[model samples]
Target: MQQIDAKQAMAFVRQRRDTTDPTYLFSDLDRERRQQAFIASVSHQLKDAGTFTDIGKMQGVLDAVSKNIVVDSDLNLIQLAQQATSLTGGNISFSTLPITGFGTSPDGASINTVDVKQVQATVKELLTPVPLAPVPTTTAIPTAATTSPAAPASEAAPASGAAAPAPATPSAPASNVYADSTGALQGGAIACVK
Candidate 1:
């Protein structure tokens, strides 16, 4: 952001006077007032862009008023302060203009102030990050109680004969290997032996 120097500012004032444009009327102020306006304009742009809240809080002043006041992601804030120092004779200081909402009726604008609740909530959230809950673990094999048991043989009996109680099929004793081999391996472990 190239700042208008005293000479340049004077030229701008002259140009405005000759062109009948009032927008540039303030370009001819004395050094103190000119510097103040310059600083204010720059600060206004920075605030509008959300660069920093108050100029008072600016860390490095010199870089703030430099060749490029643009606050893009790649812009270096330190450099901006250094530039500011070069422009305003080190007398320039950062300040957040007091905000109280004053503008035209329909189209309004404000600066240097934000919702207190919003700011507090944001700070609180940052200070205490949320913790994630632990993920649950599930067993691969379903337990008898956790799963439905097979229907009784009588209930599954053929329509006519009552199924003879399914031939009294004896329950197999539980063993390490027997339990290991599921129904798909009914031929015993040897059936899986290569």
Candidate 2:
């Protein structure tokens, strides 16, 4: 829950472990997770601090970004700013592509390997819209006079003699190694990286 300057923020996101330290195994995936977590933290902080509403602060941020980053020649800053407003509401989310396993490159460098087909399928699934569950319709209960006695188990079986489909089970939530925590100040929470 500590506030950091620009340099500190950069270091926090870009920091990597020393391969010589056997105590902790280094993974590029972990570094990427840290970067994504840092972005979320910054987004929360900016929204909480009302930096977007402050023209001076916004201009200062824009100046820094413009000087440091190269954008497409056709890119419009105003349009980008408008799109960026979505971040203020904390609607942003990040997910990493699943890696198959770790492997050594031809150069003998360790790397994360991913299945191309699986990656494509995962990306497609992520982009696809999920249909909403249908709302249940209510039915009137039959009166005692109108209702008949329950049928025997053998007679109640389906005409096709097939069993009824099982109910769908909900999937478990994904585990995140990097979690976020609230800051001491009024500003938004900072990401707690592992």
lDDT of 1 by residue, 140-168 (tens): 88878548775676565555856453233
Report the C-alpha lDDT of model 2 over 1-194, residue by residue, as the tens digit: 88889798887778767567778876787788889888788777776776665666666766676586643344444544444556655567676888999999999998889999998787776655555455555597778844878577666655486885355655433322322233222122222243
The best candidate in terms of lDDT: 2
Instruction: Score candidate 2 by TM-score against the native.
Output: 0.58
Evaluate model 1: give its TM-score: 0.19
lDDT scores of the candidates, listed in order: 0.44, 0.64
RMSD after CA superposition, every candidate: 29.4, 11.7
- Give me the displacement of residue 6 in model 1, in angstroms: 11
Q: Which residue pairs in candidate 2 have backbone atoms (N, alpha carbon, C) closer than 3 angstroms, thus clashing? A: none
Backbone collision tally, model 2: 0
